[model samples]
Target: MVDSTQRIRVGIGGWTFEPWRDNFFPAGLPHTQELHFASRAVTAIEVNGTYYSTQSPKSFARWRDETPDDFVFSLKANRFATNRRVLAEAGDSIQRFVESGLSELGQKLGPLVWQFAPTKQFDPVDFGAFLELLPKAVDGLALRHVLDVRHASFMVPAYLALARRYGCATVFADSDKFPSFADVTGDFVYARLMQSQPDCATGYEAETLARWADVARDWARGATPAGAPLVEPAHDSGAARDVFVYFINGAKERAPAAAQALIARLRTG
Candidate 1:
């Protein structure tokens, strides 16, 4: 059941971190050179800046040029698209966000993260309508979507079912601040780990990294790892799924190191 071809991309939220310079990034690493170096160290990077505002096509192209050939960039969709009162009315905003030169990233573009505010609840009729508005492709490039809904209301089976219907992945959030749930809805898995301890040098301890690596392997093999909060009982369907894991939030300064450590563990195994 294990899909050996399944890719496992371990990365941090963003490359521009002042604390990273002290350890993750080399000394005197120019702001422009940060992406150049970070891309080589991690398999992927999540573009958080795009969440705040729309960027130019030229900027996207430049980022694509800066990263390595195999590298991927997961972008957080603009807040304007998801922060509105009515979710379904965001069709125009969603279309604009997608057409805003994201195609320039080419193969380097990964999933588009639609992160809903924590206050947002799971309204099936309304939420389903919003999910329907997400385009399957932009500029002839297939788009993979990941829903990062934080409310406890999303822990319901109906939410995961809706994601499955749209072929969109529901985020596996590993955090205390938000409900930590891991359910595989689509062909791929998107996870955000936010429990890294600030005192720990590597954000997460070695044992924790090993545990996460095992979980990733299980996910790649299309089997839910034991003990993960599940919407339904876990079973092995013998179908493989691609997995993307990001070390984010909590103890933010050490996220890069945590990702690198996890990558190394996966590589050795």
Candidate 2:
């Protein structure tokens, strides 16, 4: 059973970007203050920008210093690593990218996410080789490896088995095209509630948040009844107390507000 004492570490995707604010101040806040203010309320954050470009060690050091020691940062591995025009050609780039990000983030780094493009198909043999290379690629990095595969064909049982062998968690995405939480497998699950509107790709509603919280509570309690597939329990009492919910569906203006409301519900429950 899930321990009751754990506190769910909740976080949002990156900081807010306001065009109006950009117009007012050409330059963004200094790295130290920017991270400090952005992380004031949230205990964790997913570093999406890292997926596109490499960050300087100085910038990462500033980020490490600005946040509280307890805060965790989940970084997306660079796109070139996950989406290769030629798998063989991507080897050097992937190694360099992971090393650079880990070196910069230091102790604050949480998980390293590999988000594969939706167009990519699942090829067991090729994927198996790739998975074999992953552990060695990021050998010294102390971070969880998460796979976010958006293709419908990639959810096969064989793929899941490979993921299990590698100790990688599959991402649970609530979207029109992707499979729901019930279809995925992993010890450490990464769930993204992409929307509330039945048809919309973005924006989550109140009902959706409540439903997710219910699932999270069940996960924390480690109470999967008979006839159910076993999900990885929340790490421990400390890690299971609360669920980590990110507001990716809401508009830039509404995400923070939505996050606030969801946090309140978790606290009250």
Candidate 3:
């Protein structure tokens, strides 16, 4: 499911922020090298631009070549695929995105995040049909999918059951603006920490970052931490799991710092 790199990865979303250019990238670093620099500091990155449009195969190949061999990427599926009213009718959009050039990344590609609009209510039949449209592979490369459901309607047992049935991970986003939960639904864990603060140099308070690191450790060990936000009991098959933690939203400018700090903590532990 994951590249043969480290079991746990810590990173931030996108590499094109102007604020990051000033603080995260080394001074005088060419704009073209931002991804190059960011990739070395963090093990994984959430490619947000892909959510707006499908990228060409050459672009994916360049991204793979720019990053370290062990680096990984999580792509957000295009809005065209998830922003529709009828989820069952998204087959063509879904197919176009998967065949767009995902195979170019090979194993370096992690999960495809299909994020629903906050107002999109969860319909069992429609949602099941949508999940069924997600292909298991593209061009002989195995693909992993993740559901980023935002509405409270998706916080039911049935939702988790459905996601598990398709073997797709549900995003564990730490955002007050969205329904935040850490219910495990797949073999691996994916979390988007949205509480990073601009005031804190490390994005998060040291204690909070340490807590997140511990939570990630538990997830990698195939368990959920005590008192974690959950809609149902966590599922752990006893086998170790791969964990992807991205510092996103909140204090966007401090994301790189937060990600680097979390990586340090994960390394020491």
lDDT of 2 by residue, 1-269 (tens): 64441445556678755631342223766543556765766667888988989887786777888898877788888898879744545667667776674655566777678888888888877776676666533435565677888787775677777887887777766567665443334444466656634332224566766666566555445433222233333223223323355655535445554555566667777
Worst 10 residues of 3 by lDDT: 1-10
> What local lDDT does model 2 show for residue 113?
81
Candidates 1 and 2 compared by TM-score, better number: 1
Clashing pairs in 1: none
CA lDDT for candidate 3:
0.91
The models' CA-based lDDT, in order, is 0.90, 0.62, 0.91
Give the winner by lDDT.
3
Q: What does the lDDT read for residue 86 in candidate 3?
A: 96
16-135: candidate 3 lDDT, tens digit per residue:
998987788988999889889999999999999999977999999999999999999999999999999999999999999999997899879989999999999999999999999999
Q: Against the hidden true structure, what lDDT does model 1 obtain?
A: 0.90
lDDT of 1 at 144: 98
Clash totals, every prediction: 0, 7, 0
Backbone clash pairs in model 2 (N, Cα, C under 3 Å; residues 3+ apart or in different chains), count: 7
Return the number of clashes found in candidate 1.
0
lDDT of 1 by residue, 1-269 (tens): 33443478899998998888898888888888999999999999999999998999999999999999999999999898999889989999999899999999999999999999999998999999999999999889999999999899888888888998999988888988897788788888899999989899889999989999999998887888889998777646767777899999998998988998999999887
